[model samples]
Target: MSVGKRAEPDPYSLPVPGLVRRVRRIAGISQRELARAARISHGVIGRIEKGTSMPTLPVLERILGVAGLGIVVVNDEGRVIRPMLDRADAHDGADRRYPSHLDTILDPEPGEWWGDIYGLARPPETFHRDRSRRDMQRRRSQWEVRVARHRHEPPPPKVPDYY
Candidate 1:
């Protein structure tokens, strides 16, 4: 996507790239200028502006700080305004709130618990069994092919050395 283009429509609010573009326009800064001021690469800024990359809290803060802006999240009633300084806080509580026992069973390190719970926390034993079966099939195929050598195969031709 081109820089300064919004990737999606927002039902209630502007998407990140649109907001970034608006902020940049209000600050009277170009993409290159903003990247330099934010001390980030132009490509990163372009990705952010194109809504392809979601910057981390620190990176977003730095970029927004350059434009005298910060990410603000509002409640449904618009009565509460919360600055989005923590990435974890961005998740919907229903999707993220784990049961106490499950959380204890999968004690993920900070900032590392966002992956699929089944795959990341405790993968099924069948995963290794499937991998071993696939490996055996590949090796059996190679052995079968090697054993089926053509009897009429031609011999290698010799090449003369150049002076």
Candidate 2:
């Protein structure tokens, strides 16, 4: 029996060196930091950024993961190439929105894969998130206090006892 070999990815569809750099910038991390986080050598990261080296699939995934990103394959028509699994059933209400696919033939990355939601593609800064959460909690507690106070009031003075 003979087995078929899997086809290699098209060179044209692979992400460009600049895409990695841009994502790293957006992630607000230095090249060394990304290397440290991904547990890869900084020299490898530098070469990858410089277009002097091409990262293997695993290396690319590791770097992207550290930047809070992932890769996806898309057809020429810009449609995603993944299997259509029922997102609702799979995630059980854990965020069912899909990422937007941009048509940028000139871009190094042929397809865009957004794992995060609109307006929240990148994780927010920790301090900012903490502040916002505390404000929301305070507002909620205030609302609850008002509700409790109203519930315990003296029934509006018994409606004047004559009207």
Candidate 3:
């Protein structure tokens, strides 16, 4: 064996490629069949499995959905984690999510919220979001935090408080 070379890194890592292939395998369908069922081009499915290209979230969801497989967010314990609901009137008049960093003030006193122009009829909530505080942590970092929590380990270094 040649000992002077490092292993080739997987082009797509474990998530997308493995997910696409595994879903099709479990559903007992060929890539062509999956593409037909998902109404996507067969080349796209092949590219995904070959790690030559990455599919957008919607595209992957469509393929998985066609295979009767749905993506679920889960923790280290493998239990399905429900996403945060927008039930507390989290959306504005445009039905867009407000910034998550700032506190959401529910049942606000008039000046407590800036969404008055949206003409909400006594909205159940409002966000006093500060635009400057963009706490947009990457998904990888957030997943690391969840893994730490599941392992009963201390959280990794806190993202600096920008305030």
Candidate 4:
């Protein structure tokens, strides 16, 4: 155990074995060499690459550091956005606020009402609008039924019958 290590480790959201293999190949190092560099057993590296075992965050960081590559945070569209702040930085300092344009480019704000200069609120070629329309249309019949029922229903008696 290291000086400051969590007893229970967090699981990875993304596939890391693939990434380890990719970076290891890019670094042009064998599993054994990578293990040596990261100070972990070669078997551990193999298991990590084979997806049999998961490394702790520190171990993964060490392995990635040795491969001359690091992890990146990405948006929903698979575009790399920014690296996470270090643990120390996470505790202190003002949030790194990006400009509006960068937000538009990297991660657009949700529910942005207006269309852009391109005259499209969203890209026309995307299937999202089509899917949304289909979903709404599918539910439209049910909504229309409710609306019709409300319209046809007689108004409550001017004098309440129960009262």
Tens digit of per-residue lDDT, candidate 3, span 1-163: 1225667856467578888888888889999999998889999999998888998878888988976888787766999999776653677678877675555666777655556656656666765454433233333376575785556655544534332
lDDT per residue as tens, model 4, 1-163: 1235555634654588998898688789999999999999999999888888989889989998986776677665999897444432222125543232211222333333134434665521111223333344435545556776657654432321111
Q: Compared with the true structure, what per-residue lDDT tens digits does model 1 show for residues 74-144?
A: 65588667442433432333545323212122333433333344355431111112333334454555555
For candidate 1, give the lDDT.
0.56
Q: How do all models score by TM-score? A: 0.40, 0.43, 0.51, 0.41
User: For model 1, where is the 10-residue window of minimal lDDT?
Assistant: 122-131
User: Which number leads on TM-score?
Assistant: 3
Cα lDDT, all candidates: 0.56, 0.58, 0.71, 0.60
Clashes of each: 0, 0, 0, 0
Which residue pairs does candidate 2 place in steric collision? none
Which is better, 1 or 2, measured by lDDT? 2
Report the lDDT of model 2 for residue 95: 52
Quality of model 4 by C-alpha lDDT: 0.60
Which wins on TM-score, candidate 1 or candidate 2?
2
State the weakest 10-residue window (summed lDDT) of model 2.
102-111
